[model samples]
Target: MPRPVRRFHPLLFVSACAVVLAACASERTLTPEQYEQRLPALEARAEANPSNAAALRDLGEAYAQTGAYRQAENVLQRAEAAAPDDPKTLYYLGVSKEGLEQPDAALTVFARYRDLPPRSRFQQLMAGRHGWLLRALLRDELAALVAAEDSLTAEGVTEAIAVFPLTYQGQDSLYRPLGRGLSEMLTVDLASVEGLRVVERLRLQTLLDELALTQNAAFDAETVPRLGRLLRSGRVVGGVLDVQNEQLRTDVALWDWPSEPLPGLSSRQAGLAELFALEKEIVFDLLVQLGIELAPAEREALARVPTRDLQAFLAYSRGLLEEDAGRFVEAAAFYSQAVRLDPGFAEAAQKNQEAQAMAEVAGGVDMALAAPRRSARPPGGTSLVHNRLTLLNQNLGAHVVPGDEAREPTADVPLDPLGAEPIPDPPPPPAGGN
Candidate 1:
């Protein structure tokens, strides 16, 4: 044996070591039942080593798996303190917040997680979480506003207005996209007014989706005041769009909750080819109806159109519809088309990136119901978003534990894992207990 040891090969030793590591790696993936079995030991380990972030994180994850969100949140918070920049700890903490129905807190934590360095591993996941929570918050706010309307008065932010999607009276689906596009244009132009506040188009869209407003379904007269209160706007604008013989006509009605008499309607008509000019005229007329004396500078800002190309605007409008419907993949495609049709269309470009980011993070997973990633560029190359997704998909088992990695999926593991399972809401914790 001593003589044979004289020719021991380092390459052979390396190969043997690799085989052992492979076996260990395979054993790390445990079934839900197996994870449950290890809870007692994990808890004991964490309790014995209060400062051990790894042990605390593991115990917290086990609690989360069992739907003990309060316990998980407490433990994960401690783990976060022990390891301040640990992405996995923060991720679990965010999930626990979600389970507790504290979407705002979850959003803050997820934002922190998304902003962490080396984002290539979990960027998509965090982006998806952002979109998901934002939409949920919008729905919740609308519900809360409606419930609290009895105590709410006509009093609201005096200069603020929410421009809702136009009710398209036109028969052609080809012109239906204008409902979203025209309102968005109005919102943009009106925002230039010095003293006036414009409610974001996203807020209006989400609320409309919540209201289940159909293409031709007009805004309910009864709900108008409530919508203004929810949007924190004293004034609300709803419009109707009609097209006939290549002539475009838009009529906007103003609802002022505070005033005894409602503002008069404003109407504009122009050729389809002069859509931008028509939109500008509508903006000026809206200002006049609101009794807002626009300064020269404000008029200049309002005159700037988003895009001159009608096709690009149409594509952008289609993207808006898809986005409002939560069909992020389709939205991204339409946005991209808009961007291509007119490269200077900044809004379309921005929307395209946002839609793509959301789609990437959602990855067609049931964790969130956005569409999957179909990269315009090949994912195998140096694309940052693609790389992030690739790393998450390919390196799930071997990633660093309890610090830089994501929460390991255990309970009813997803077919295409995004590395974390949904933690259902748990019962409230006992009084005076963590």
Candidate 2:
């Protein structure tokens, strides 16, 4: 047995591994303009090495980016044949399918991309991009559905609605949870705004549960109308999900509950984080459609609350939110706390000052009368003049005769003795001589 043993060629094994890796790592980096300029070079490369899958894939991507879908398909198909199981070739083919508006076919390619090893940097990038595109497409479909719903004026219109995962082959359950989480987060964020209403997933799930409905189950159009009426929501959001290049892509859509013919909004994208962000944006637009007013305070709160190191700012936002909610006392407390945390936090300091002033004014008649009215009048208008005089008399009487109250002194709080002298009138306007 020892004498019959054979030796393997190390160099040959290394070469084979390198070729496989190259095929697996195949990606095109040419920008649209660069791709256009290098088309001739790519063509020459392909002509010189007809079996070079990488070159063919790159050329196909270049063609797809330039709107040459048919040519891209042809080139990508050849690449696929050349490297039957190569993820890179599969991804390029998917891109070509997308360019051709064949999303179903493209999804299959993206699915294969998702199954690649996570350590591949090329796969990572493609996965993220593919997920993003898929989510965007789903969002577009949703928007069309919403639009269809808006187009309907009838009191009773029915439509069927189903949402499911769209992964390559049958890997459906893997990314579905992310899709559901994203939908719920979006609904919650949007619903938190005043004058906006979003249908929460729990309610939807409950309804489905009551009916023993699964994602594959189809409800009648008339049933949708009834569901819409019960939910008090005219639109429904749904989507498909897939994995590409070890990344997840989701396509979400908003559609009319009973008339799902048109989409209200649709978007496809890669990565759960990006999909969540897009969902926020879509919800924001929906709020706008529902006539929700995002106040300046709300906007500022949102901008500041998400920052980890901005504790003072977060406290300030809490204060403002409380104030807007008519919890002035709580607002003052928050603002004061904020100022204590960061003495130089000017906005918080100012808010604290205003809240204190307001509190004093609310409790004391003198403070209430002393505070300036917010109006478009000149600084020392009639009311201000009267108030100033009243304050002067009260102070003077307090000093001269305790407990002897007097009407506020008119327009003349005594100035500092060294203050500039008042300028004399110009001879009484020259006695109106003009």
Candidate 3:
């Protein structure tokens, strides 16, 4: 008799493989001494052929590996100029940008790299890095992009803008709404301008998340340049809010999206009693500074305040801030508060419904971070599944949902010619079956 054969066990096999992979990841792949030794040869090759993009890119990677990000960036910039469309050059450039704590520039570089078509597996690796960047930069847009669609790819009608959260120099904690509230209101106002697209607030938070900024220190003059590059915004709006004698005074400033100031501040003072009108005033002034002229109807439309109740408006503002931070359930609660305070608050009601829907679609922010993005799959793969499901749902008809069946159209079968004309019984069965 043959000896009994041992059987394979899946649990043990999986455990062993996981242990090996974790060990590999935890271990250092390259020592500094090893990198230093390899750097000299690459530098010599790059110096010999200064215009050669491939040689320069390799040398730049070596520099970055050795923690010399300054040198890496300088060399990679030159390489990029030489090979404007090169994917590898773009990737290493992004790496150096990240090492230098310049996430905005890195994001911009990765965005360009993601659009390039790949020719090999290595090129696909570059595309994969782009996918990772997208998850970090545009969280809400991830699922849409994964579904083979991009909402941000539309051509520039005029210029893009990034609106930083408003700053409150006052010492009152209760006045916190002025910070996010005003900035969000400004974003809405500017977004209504025909030729301009305001960067979504969540995208700004994504940038802030990379910087690990506390809410208090997220935006300032020094950071605006990087923020602008990251959002690809040509203009940025920032403001300071202070209260004196029960009156609210706001100073709004426009920057050229990097560092330069546009012209002058757009200042407004309003009685706290009429605070609802201040947002519209600031919006109109900013529009003038950006050279956007709105028609009478458009201006009137933008002028409409969401709610007159200060507490309700503040709650809605808090909702926007929460939603931006990916706390949809909390945001919905905030919006619900606003709606309850002012039942006719249409904007707040709509936002409440939206937040609840998003909460259901995504359990939390972590899901959005790990959700499938467009670059994670082969082109058209996710979309194919989406399309097939859509077709299936449509074909099943409204009857599948327990609705009235009479509303849906029945299939149009061809006229039954055999039923109408019976061919005279097939000529008497061919004379008694021949």
Scored by TM-score, the top model is 1
Clashes of 1: 0
Error of 3 at 161 (Å): 1.3
Q: How close is every model to the real structure, measured as TM-score?
A: 0.66, 0.31, 0.48
Maximum-lDDT candidate? 1
Stretch of 10 with least lDDT, candidate 3:
399-408
Could you give candidate 1's per-residue lDDT for residues 1-434 as a string of tens digits?
01110112335434433553453244323344655777776776776678978778777877765667899899999998988766656766777787787879988987874465533323445555677677778878887766776787766446588888898888766777888899888887777677778899888777766767664453556666666766777778887888877789988887776564544567788888788899888778778877878677766777888898877788789779888888665566567666766788888877766665575444212232211122212223333232332333233221111111111111122212222222222333335543
Q: Which residue pairs show collisions in model 1? A: none
lDDT of 2 by residue, 246-272 (tens): 355555555566445645335455443
lDDT of each: 0.63, 0.46, 0.58
For model 3, how does the per-residue alpha-carbon lDDT over 1-434 read when each residue is reduced to its tens digit?
A: 21121222335434433553453244333444665777766676676677977667767766776778899899989888887766656766776787787767876886674465533222333444444444554654443333443344323323678887877777655566667877877787788789888887767766676566655564565566555654667687876787666678887787774446444667788876567788787788878877888899998898888788776777677778777676654565567666766777887876765554344224222222122221122323222112222222233211011111111111122111112210011111222222
